[model samples]
Target: MKADETIVNGVRIGGAETKVGEDIRTIELPSGARAEVRKGYGRDLMRAQRAAANGDASAVVFALIAEVTRVDGHKIVYEDVLEMDLADVMALQAEVIDENFDRPPQRASQASSNPDSQSEH
Candidate 1:
Protein backbone atom coordinates (compact mmCIF):
# COMPACT_ATOMS: atom_id res chain seq x y z
CA MET A 1 0.00 0.00 0.00
CA LYS A 2 1.12 3.54 -0.62
CA ALA A 3 2.04 5.80 2.22
CA ASP A 4 -1.21 7.67 1.71
CA GLU A 5 -3.15 4.59 0.67
CA THR A 6 -5.25 2.81 3.29
CA ILE A 7 -7.17 -0.43 3.13
CA VAL A 8 -9.86 -1.46 5.55
CA ASN A 9 -11.75 -4.73 5.28
CA GLY A 10 -10.34 -5.11 1.78
CA VAL A 11 -11.84 -1.80 0.69
CA ARG A 12 -9.58 0.85 -0.77
CA ILE A 13 -9.60 4.29 0.86
CA GLY A 14 -8.78 7.65 -0.71
CA GLY A 15 -10.12 11.13 -1.31
CA ALA A 16 -12.05 9.93 -4.34
CA GLU A 17 -12.58 6.33 -3.25
CA THR A 18 -15.75 5.60 -1.35
CA LYS A 19 -18.47 2.98 -1.17
CA VAL A 20 -17.45 0.42 1.42
CA GLY A 21 -19.20 -2.93 1.86
CA GLU A 22 -20.23 -4.98 4.85
CA ASP A 23 -17.14 -7.12 5.04
CA ILE A 24 -16.34 -8.08 8.59
CA ARG A 25 -14.03 -10.83 9.70
CA THR A 26 -12.11 -12.31 12.60
CA ILE A 27 -8.37 -12.06 12.65
CA GLU A 28 -5.42 -12.82 14.86
CA LEU A 29 -3.31 -10.00 16.23
CA PRO A 30 0.43 -9.88 16.16
CA SER A 31 0.40 -11.19 19.72
CA GLY A 32 -1.54 -14.25 18.60
CA ALA A 33 -4.72 -12.72 19.92
CA ARG A 34 -7.99 -13.11 18.02
CA ALA A 35 -10.98 -10.82 17.71
CA GLU A 36 -13.96 -10.05 15.54
CA VAL A 37 -13.87 -6.84 13.54
CA ARG A 38 -16.68 -5.22 11.56
CA LYS A 39 -16.42 -3.62 8.15
CA GLY A 40 -17.75 -0.11 7.48
CA TYR A 41 -18.95 1.21 4.15
CA GLY A 42 -20.36 4.25 2.28
CA ARG A 43 -21.16 6.49 5.18
CA ASP A 44 -17.87 5.68 6.79
CA LEU A 45 -15.98 6.53 3.62
CA MET A 46 -17.80 9.84 3.21
CA ARG A 47 -17.01 10.77 6.78
CA ALA A 48 -13.39 9.89 6.20
CA GLN A 49 -13.28 12.06 3.09
CA ARG A 50 -14.78 15.00 4.93
CA ALA A 51 -12.24 14.55 7.63
CA ALA A 52 -9.42 14.49 5.13
CA ALA A 53 -10.73 17.55 3.31
CA ASN A 54 -11.11 19.43 6.57
CA GLY A 55 -7.36 19.51 7.06
CA ASP A 56 -7.49 16.01 8.50
CA ALA A 57 -4.90 13.36 7.85
CA SER A 58 -5.30 10.83 5.08
CA ALA A 59 -7.90 8.08 5.40
CA VAL A 60 -5.10 5.57 5.67
CA VAL A 61 -4.24 6.79 9.13
CA PHE A 62 -7.84 6.61 10.18
CA ALA A 63 -8.23 3.09 8.83
CA LEU A 64 -5.18 1.93 10.75
CA ILE A 65 -6.53 3.16 14.05
CA ALA A 66 -7.76 -0.21 15.23
CA GLU A 67 -9.22 -0.99 18.61
CA VAL A 68 -7.56 -3.89 20.36
CA THR A 69 -8.48 -4.88 23.86
CA ARG A 70 -8.09 -8.09 25.85
CA VAL A 71 -11.08 -9.43 27.71
CA ASP A 72 -10.58 -10.95 31.13
CA GLY A 73 -11.69 -14.50 30.30
CA HIS A 74 -12.42 -14.25 26.60
CA LYS A 75 -10.03 -13.53 23.78
CA ILE A 76 -9.26 -9.98 22.77
CA VAL A 77 -12.11 -8.22 20.99
CA TYR A 78 -11.85 -5.67 18.21
CA GLU A 79 -14.71 -3.59 16.89
CA ASP A 80 -15.39 -0.63 14.57
CA VAL A 81 -12.93 -1.60 11.91
CA LEU A 82 -13.53 1.53 9.84
CA GLU A 83 -14.06 3.72 12.85
CA MET A 84 -11.48 6.37 13.65
CA ASP A 85 -10.99 8.95 16.34
CA LEU A 86 -11.38 12.03 14.14
CA ALA A 87 -10.08 14.26 16.88
CA ASP A 88 -6.69 12.58 16.71
CA VAL A 89 -6.32 12.85 12.96
CA MET A 90 -7.62 16.39 12.88
CA ALA A 91 -5.05 17.47 15.40
CA LEU A 92 -2.22 15.90 13.45
CA GLN A 93 -3.40 17.43 10.22
CA ALA A 94 -3.93 20.81 11.83
CA GLU A 95 -0.38 20.91 13.01
CA VAL A 96 0.95 19.98 9.61
CA ILE A 97 -1.23 22.56 7.93
CA ASP A 98 -0.22 25.22 10.39
CA GLU A 99 3.43 24.51 9.90
CA ASN A 100 3.23 24.35 6.14
CA PHE A 101 0.80 27.20 5.74
CA ASP A 102 2.41 29.24 8.52
CA ARG A 103 -0.91 30.11 10.01
CA PRO A 104 -1.11 32.42 12.94
CA PRO A 105 -1.07 30.99 16.43
CA GLN A 106 -4.42 30.11 17.84
CA ARG A 107 -5.83 31.75 20.95
CA ALA A 108 -6.05 29.93 24.26
CA SER A 109 -9.77 29.38 23.87
CA GLN A 110 -9.36 28.03 20.36
CA ALA A 111 -6.45 25.89 21.37
CA SER A 112 -8.27 24.53 24.38
CA SER A 113 -11.21 23.49 22.29
CA ASN A 114 -8.92 21.58 19.95
CA PRO A 115 -8.52 17.90 20.79
CA ASP A 116 -4.92 18.10 19.59
CA SER A 117 -4.09 20.90 22.00
CA GLN A 118 -2.32 18.50 24.27
CA SER A 119 0.25 17.80 21.57
CA GLU A 120 0.66 21.49 20.79
CA HIS A 121 1.74 22.20 24.33
Candidate 2:
Protein backbone atom coordinates (compact mmCIF):
# COMPACT_ATOMS: atom_id res chain seq x y z
CA MET A 1 0.00 0.00 0.00
CA LYS A 2 1.16 3.56 -0.67
CA ALA A 3 2.05 5.90 2.16
CA ASP A 4 -1.16 7.87 1.69
CA GLU A 5 -3.25 4.68 1.60
CA THR A 6 -4.72 2.65 4.43
CA ILE A 7 -6.65 -0.58 4.78
CA VAL A 8 -9.87 -0.38 6.72
CA ASN A 9 -11.86 -3.56 7.36
CA GLY A 10 -9.58 -5.21 4.80
CA VAL A 11 -10.46 -2.70 2.08
CA ARG A 12 -7.78 -0.46 0.60
CA ILE A 13 -8.55 3.27 0.61
CA GLY A 14 -6.81 6.62 -0.10
CA GLY A 15 -4.24 7.72 -2.68
CA ALA A 16 -4.43 10.34 -5.37
CA GLU A 17 -6.83 8.37 -7.49
CA THR A 18 -9.55 8.08 -4.89
CA LYS A 19 -12.53 10.42 -4.73
CA VAL A 20 -12.97 13.05 -1.98
CA GLY A 21 -15.01 11.25 0.66
CA GLU A 22 -13.59 7.80 -0.06
CA ASP A 23 -10.14 8.72 1.26
CA ILE A 24 -8.77 7.32 4.52
CA ARG A 25 -6.71 9.32 7.01
CA THR A 26 -3.92 7.89 9.13
CA ILE A 27 -3.29 9.18 12.63
CA GLU A 28 -0.24 8.45 14.76
CA LEU A 29 -1.11 8.30 18.42
CA PRO A 30 0.95 9.13 21.48
CA SER A 31 1.36 5.41 22.11
CA GLY A 32 3.24 5.10 18.82
CA ALA A 33 0.33 3.13 17.41
CA ARG A 34 -1.32 4.35 14.25
CA ALA A 35 -5.05 4.40 13.63
CA GLU A 36 -6.82 4.49 10.30
CA VAL A 37 -10.04 6.48 10.24
CA ARG A 38 -12.51 6.94 7.45
CA LYS A 39 -15.10 9.61 6.77
CA GLY A 40 -18.38 8.38 8.25
CA TYR A 41 -21.77 8.51 6.55
CA GLY A 42 -25.20 9.16 7.98
CA ARG A 43 -25.76 5.46 8.61
CA ASP A 44 -22.55 5.25 10.64
CA LEU A 45 -23.59 8.18 12.80
CA MET A 46 -27.06 6.71 13.30
CA ARG A 47 -25.55 3.40 14.38
CA ALA A 48 -23.18 5.13 16.77
CA GLN A 49 -25.98 7.18 18.28
CA ARG A 50 -28.01 4.02 18.81
CA ALA A 51 -25.03 2.38 20.48
CA ALA A 52 -24.88 5.27 22.91
CA ALA A 53 -27.91 4.86 25.12
CA ASN A 54 -29.60 7.45 27.35
CA GLY A 55 -28.48 10.22 25.01
CA ASP A 56 -25.04 10.31 26.57
CA ALA A 57 -22.89 12.69 24.51
CA SER A 58 -19.57 11.13 25.44
CA ALA A 59 -20.83 7.67 24.73
CA VAL A 60 -21.97 8.78 21.30
CA VAL A 61 -18.53 10.16 20.49
CA PHE A 62 -16.83 7.03 21.70
CA ALA A 63 -19.22 4.86 19.75
CA LEU A 64 -18.50 6.91 16.65
CA ILE A 65 -14.79 6.35 17.17
CA ALA A 66 -15.29 2.61 17.38
CA GLU A 67 -17.46 2.69 14.29
CA VAL A 68 -14.88 4.46 12.10
CA THR A 69 -11.47 3.72 13.60
CA ARG A 70 -9.08 0.79 13.18
CA VAL A 71 -5.87 0.43 15.14
CA ASP A 72 -3.05 -1.40 13.43
CA GLY A 73 -5.63 -2.56 10.92
CA HIS A 74 -7.61 -4.36 13.69
CA LYS A 75 -11.15 -3.47 14.64
CA ILE A 76 -11.73 -2.19 18.14
CA VAL A 77 -14.79 -2.04 20.37
CA TYR A 78 -16.14 0.95 22.26
CA GLU A 79 -14.80 -0.47 25.49
CA ASP A 80 -11.37 -0.79 23.97
CA VAL A 81 -11.45 2.90 23.06
CA LEU A 82 -12.43 3.84 26.59
CA GLU A 83 -9.40 1.97 27.86
CA MET A 84 -7.00 3.97 25.70
CA ASP A 85 -4.80 6.72 27.10
CA LEU A 86 -6.18 10.23 27.26
CA ALA A 87 -3.86 11.65 24.65
CA ASP A 88 -4.52 8.85 22.21
CA VAL A 89 -8.23 9.11 22.73
CA MET A 90 -8.13 12.86 22.13
CA ALA A 91 -6.15 12.34 18.95
CA LEU A 92 -8.63 9.78 17.71
CA GLN A 93 -11.55 12.01 18.60
CA ALA A 94 -10.06 15.00 16.81
CA GLU A 95 -9.44 13.08 13.63
CA VAL A 96 -12.76 11.24 13.63
CA ILE A 97 -14.91 14.22 14.57
CA ASP A 98 -13.16 16.71 12.36
CA GLU A 99 -13.30 14.55 9.28
CA ASN A 100 -16.93 13.55 9.76
CA PHE A 101 -18.58 16.40 11.59
CA ASP A 102 -16.63 19.61 10.98
CA ARG A 103 -17.61 21.65 7.97
CA PRO A 104 -15.30 24.00 6.14
CA PRO A 105 -16.22 27.65 6.09
CA GLN A 106 -18.02 28.69 2.94
CA ARG A 107 -16.27 31.26 0.77
CA ALA A 108 -17.80 34.73 0.53
CA SER A 109 -18.91 34.29 -3.07
CA GLN A 110 -20.46 30.90 -2.43
CA ALA A 111 -22.25 32.06 0.71
CA SER A 112 -23.56 35.16 -1.09
CA SER A 113 -24.91 33.01 -3.91
CA ASN A 114 -27.31 31.30 -1.49
CA PRO A 115 -29.18 33.31 1.12
CA ASP A 116 -29.98 30.09 3.02
CA SER A 117 -26.28 29.50 3.56
CA GLN A 118 -25.89 32.44 5.91
CA SER A 119 -24.21 31.61 9.20
CA GLU A 120 -26.58 31.07 12.09
CA HIS A 121 -24.10 32.63 14.43
Candidate 3:
Protein backbone atom coordinates (compact mmCIF):
# COMPACT_ATOMS: atom_id res chain seq x y z
CA MET A 1 0.00 0.00 0.00
CA LYS A 2 1.29 3.46 -0.86
CA ALA A 3 2.07 5.75 2.02
CA ASP A 4 -0.41 8.23 0.67
CA GLU A 5 -3.06 5.56 0.16
CA THR A 6 -5.18 4.32 3.08
CA ILE A 7 -7.10 1.08 3.43
CA VAL A 8 -10.27 0.41 5.47
CA ASN A 9 -12.05 -2.91 5.74
CA GLY A 10 -15.76 -3.23 5.09
CA VAL A 11 -18.17 -0.27 4.85
CA ARG A 12 -17.67 1.47 1.49
CA ILE A 13 -18.22 4.80 3.21
CA GLY A 14 -15.97 7.88 3.18
CA GLY A 15 -15.18 9.19 -0.25
CA ALA A 16 -16.22 12.67 0.88
CA GLU A 17 -16.08 12.02 4.62
CA THR A 18 -12.29 12.01 4.61
CA LYS A 19 -12.23 15.50 3.18
CA VAL A 20 -12.92 16.92 6.66
CA GLY A 21 -9.56 16.27 8.20
CA GLU A 22 -9.26 15.66 11.92
CA ASP A 23 -8.37 18.30 14.49
CA ILE A 24 -5.94 16.46 16.72
CA ARG A 25 -5.65 17.48 20.35
CA THR A 26 -4.28 15.78 23.42
CA ILE A 27 -6.56 16.16 26.43
CA GLU A 28 -6.00 15.00 29.97
CA LEU A 29 -9.22 14.26 31.77
CA PRO A 30 -9.78 14.75 35.50
CA SER A 31 -8.56 11.16 35.87
CA GLY A 32 -5.10 12.11 34.60
CA ALA A 33 -5.18 9.95 31.45
CA ARG A 34 -4.23 11.77 28.25
CA ALA A 35 -6.54 11.36 25.26
CA GLU A 36 -5.34 12.04 21.75
CA VAL A 37 -8.48 13.45 20.19
CA ARG A 38 -9.20 13.28 16.45
CA LYS A 39 -12.34 15.25 15.78
CA GLY A 40 -14.22 14.87 12.49
CA TYR A 41 -17.26 16.56 10.95
CA GLY A 42 -20.95 16.09 11.81
CA ARG A 43 -21.58 14.01 8.69
CA ASP A 44 -19.24 11.25 9.83
CA LEU A 45 -20.88 11.35 13.26
CA MET A 46 -24.32 10.85 11.73
CA ARG A 47 -23.00 7.99 9.62
CA ALA A 48 -21.65 6.28 12.71
CA GLN A 49 -24.96 6.72 14.53
CA ARG A 50 -26.74 5.27 11.52
CA ALA A 51 -24.38 2.31 11.45
CA ALA A 52 -24.97 1.76 15.14
CA ALA A 53 -28.70 1.70 14.52
CA ASN A 54 -28.28 -1.06 11.89
CA GLY A 55 -26.03 -3.50 13.78
CA ASP A 56 -22.86 -4.29 15.82
CA ALA A 57 -21.01 -1.59 13.96
CA SER A 58 -22.32 0.91 16.53
CA ALA A 59 -19.77 0.10 19.26
CA VAL A 60 -16.99 -0.30 16.73
CA VAL A 61 -17.66 2.69 14.52
CA PHE A 62 -19.20 5.23 16.87
CA ALA A 63 -17.25 4.46 20.02
CA LEU A 64 -13.90 3.63 18.47
CA ILE A 65 -14.34 6.05 15.55
CA ALA A 66 -13.53 3.70 12.64
CA GLU A 67 -10.62 1.28 12.25
CA VAL A 68 -11.72 -2.00 13.90
CA THR A 69 -10.29 -2.47 17.37
CA ARG A 70 -11.07 -3.50 20.94
CA VAL A 71 -13.43 -1.18 22.81
CA ASP A 72 -11.86 -1.08 26.27
CA GLY A 73 -8.95 1.19 27.21
CA HIS A 74 -7.69 3.91 29.55
CA LYS A 75 -5.53 6.00 27.25
CA ILE A 76 -7.34 6.74 24.01
CA VAL A 77 -4.68 7.63 21.45
CA TYR A 78 -7.27 8.10 18.68
CA GLU A 79 -6.53 4.62 17.23
CA ASP A 80 -4.68 2.54 19.81
CA VAL A 81 -7.78 1.92 21.91
CA LEU A 82 -9.48 -1.46 22.02
CA GLU A 83 -13.10 -1.30 23.23
CA MET A 84 -14.23 1.98 24.74
CA ASP A 85 -16.32 1.30 27.83
CA LEU A 86 -19.64 3.05 28.30
CA ALA A 87 -18.31 5.63 30.72
CA ASP A 88 -15.17 6.30 28.74
CA VAL A 89 -16.96 6.72 25.39
CA MET A 90 -19.64 8.91 26.97
CA ALA A 91 -17.08 11.22 28.56
CA LEU A 92 -15.02 11.36 25.40
CA GLN A 93 -18.08 12.00 23.27
CA ALA A 94 -18.87 15.09 25.36
CA GLU A 95 -15.34 16.40 25.06
CA VAL A 96 -15.14 15.41 21.39
CA ILE A 97 -18.26 17.36 20.45
CA ASP A 98 -17.42 20.31 22.68
CA GLU A 99 -20.03 19.04 25.20
CA ASN A 100 -22.68 19.69 22.57
CA PHE A 101 -23.45 16.00 22.21
CA ASP A 102 -27.09 16.71 23.06
CA ARG A 103 -27.49 17.03 19.29
CA PRO A 104 -25.55 17.85 16.16
CA PRO A 105 -25.04 21.55 15.53
CA GLN A 106 -27.59 22.70 12.99
CA ARG A 107 -30.13 25.44 12.42
CA ALA A 108 -33.07 24.97 14.74
CA SER A 109 -36.47 24.65 13.10
CA GLN A 110 -38.66 27.67 13.88
CA ALA A 111 -42.26 27.20 15.01
CA SER A 112 -45.22 29.61 14.74
CA SER A 113 -46.63 29.87 18.26
CA ASN A 114 -49.60 32.01 17.22
CA PRO A 115 -52.72 29.82 17.10
CA ASP A 116 -54.59 32.50 15.12
CA SER A 117 -52.12 31.99 12.26
CA GLN A 118 -53.57 28.49 11.79
CA SER A 119 -56.83 30.10 10.48
CA GLU A 120 -60.29 28.31 10.64
CA HIS A 121 -59.99 25.91 13.58
Best by TM-score: 2
TM-score of each: 0.27, 0.67, 0.38
Report the poorest 10 consecutive residues by lDDT, candidate 1.
68-77
Point out the higher-scoring one by lDDT: 2 or 3. Answer: 2
How do the residues 63-96 of candidate 2 rate in per-residue lDDT, one tens digit apiece?
8898788889776767889999999999999999
lDDT of 3 by residue, 1-121 (tens): 4343333444344232223554555655444555555555565555455545555643534533542111223222233333445565665655655632347667644435665566684
Tens-place lDDT digits, model 1, residues 22-119: 33354444334453334443454454454445545544334323221111223211123234244533443343233323557667786678887657
Runs with alpha carbons beyond 4 Å of true place in candidate 1: 1-23, 53-57, 64-121
Poorly placed runs, candidate 3 (over 4 Å)? 2-6, 9-22, 30-32, 46-82, 99-121
Candidate 1, residue 83: lDDT? 40
RMSD of 3: 7.9
Q: Give the Cα error of residue 43 in candidate 3, in Å.
A: 6.0
Query: What residue pairs are clashing in model 2?
Result: none
Q: Provide C-alpha RMSD values for all models, in order.
A: 15.5, 9.7, 7.9
